[model samples]
Target: MRSRRVLFAVHDWGLGHATRCLVLIRALVERGDEVTVLMAPSPGLQLLKAELGQQCTFYPYPDIPKPLGRSPPMFYAAMTGALPLIWARFKREHRLTERLVRKHRFERVITDSRLGVWSRTAPSYCIFHSLRQIVPGRSPAIERLVERGQRRLLKPYRKVLIPDFAENGGLSGDLGHDPQLDWGAGRLVYIGPLSGVRRQNVPEDIDYFFSLSGLEPQRSLLEQRVQAALPRLSGRIVVARGRLDAAGDQEQKGNATIYGYLDRHAQAEMLNRARLVFTRSGYTTLMELAELGKRALLVPTPGQSEQEYLAQFHHERGHAWSTTQRRLDIVRDLARAQGTTGIPQHATADSVQRFLDAIS
Candidate 1:
């Protein structure tokens, strides 16, 4: 088989999409394909660059502006207000994608939740977990409209690759498996969970590990909460402040250590060594936790219905513990988190290799 030139684009919503693509990117590079990443100069993209290094090329790409607000209600309101801007950005992304395809002459295009980044010149694929985009309130008409719009947006892609299991009811609950928003058979490829974290057979020395990420004011709000709670918690605490653009700085205060960011290896090691962890309930983080067999206290980003649902879904299933930012009683919740079984670590090496083969 001959090597193909691949162009990959990721949405800059949060670090999850970009981090999850690391698995695919590494696989493509290791297979001797020329891979080029089209992403904004965001923290997630920066982290990707550091991880991929010389294995792939990078290009500055356009991204939609983040919906901003201090709280959940405000966030939803801001998202509603930004609809026109988001639509305009989508159009711009289409033009930019076309231009990149012409210039780079890519043989394949893979987008992680970036709707407009596909091309007719290449075999384009969209890798996303969400089929039904859940909002705060449920409206039959709104749901139908969302489904229809999603279907139209995905039409340019060769296939929508869901990074989840087809069997075992999937990892993403209703987000990935919803009969109402079905995209028909043969349209989706269940690629299992794509995660880059490698587990180590090490002793669990750290009592608590806080993996902080996402767009802020929420991120900042969580940071403040964690900082306040740190004094009350005992044993070694490690905080990986997911700031990719910042320097790799570390600060040690007695039993607690905070780092600006951790590479894939450091993250894996820290997560593996921790007895209990605290992190956002992002899909990628959940996948990583499952892959490593670690349990966490999940605080879903406010207004993000998907994350909120995931947090509750896992909690109900005894997979993990969850609490809102406003009601985060750290000491009490950590004790509660200790008892819940984590999301089952079921992703095998065979499934991962099959995922690579599908793209190849």
Candidate 2:
């Protein structure tokens, strides 16, 4: 295979998108591809730089503003009002992509949910899981409209790579698998779970592992709540604050240890050793849980419909126990979660190779 100059664009919504892309990006680098990453100035970008080092070139690119609200209704309203701004950002990025592709002569373009990062001259692909955006009221009409709009946005990409299994309804459930949408034949490919965290043969000595992540006030809110209840919790507890901006300091309390953040390798080691994992019901984290076959207590971010839906989906399936951030009780929720079965184990060893093969 001839070495190809590839341009990868990542959405800076959260660390999940950046972390999941690491698997594919590392594979690209190992295969001798010249990879250039385009992303906004974010902790995710910083993480990628720290992980990839000199393996890939980094370019600072602006992404759409994160229209997060303090509550669910507000969030929906904000998103609806931000449509024009989102469209403008898309146009801006599309223009920038054209210039970048022309200047650098990139042979392939890949975007992780950045709608405007594709080029007409290159074989462009998108990495996305949510094909149908779940509305607050679960209105079929609204959901169908949202699905159609998403499909239109994805039309530029040669393939939309879903990081999930195609069988057993996959890990995403209704979020990725929508029977109503006409996903063009061979256009949407399920490339399995693109989790950077691999299951390791390590002792499950840690009683609990809490990996906190998500956007804005909600993330901070969760942190404050969890910190307040930490003193009441028992057993060997490990908490990753998911604070990418803060220093990676490991603080030890009586029976608990907390860190500002944990990188991929450190996170993987912790996950392997943890008897019970607790995290936000983000798709990326769920994929990691599936990969490691770990049971978890899921608390979805308020106002984020995707996370909320995913939490409920898994909860209903008896795969994991879930609760809202507002009603989370560390002791009670943890006990309930332990009763539920963990995610079914899946083979992700070939997921990256499958992705490469699909693109090739």
In the range 1-360, model 1's lDDT, one tens digit per residue, is 688889999887777778788877887888788999989887778878888898889988768877878787888899889989988988888888888889988889999988878888888999978877776676777867877788888988888888887865677986787647667667788878877776788999999999998787788788888888888888999998877655488998677899988877888899999998899999988888888878889999888878898898888888899998889899999999999887778564645686676776
CA lDDT of every candidate: 0.84, 0.90
Model 2, range 1-360, lDDT digits (tens) per residue? Answer: 988999999998888889889889999999889999999999889989999999999999889988889999888899989999999999999999999999999999999999989999999999999899888889999889988999999999999999898887788888888558787889988899878788788899998998988888888999898888888888899999988666578889888899998877888999999999989998888988988899999999999899999999999989999999888898899999999899867766688989999888
Which numbered prediction scores highest in lDDT against the true structure? Answer: 2
Query: Model 1 segments beyond 4 Å from truth?
Result: 244-248
Candidate 1 pairs with clashing backbones: none
Model 2 Cα displacement at 348 (Å)?
2.8
Give each prediction's root-mean-square deviation over alpha carbons.
1.9, 1.3
Error of 1 at 125 (Å): 0.5
Error of 2 at 10 (Å): 0.8
Candidate 2, poorest ten consecutive residues by summed lDDT: 242-251
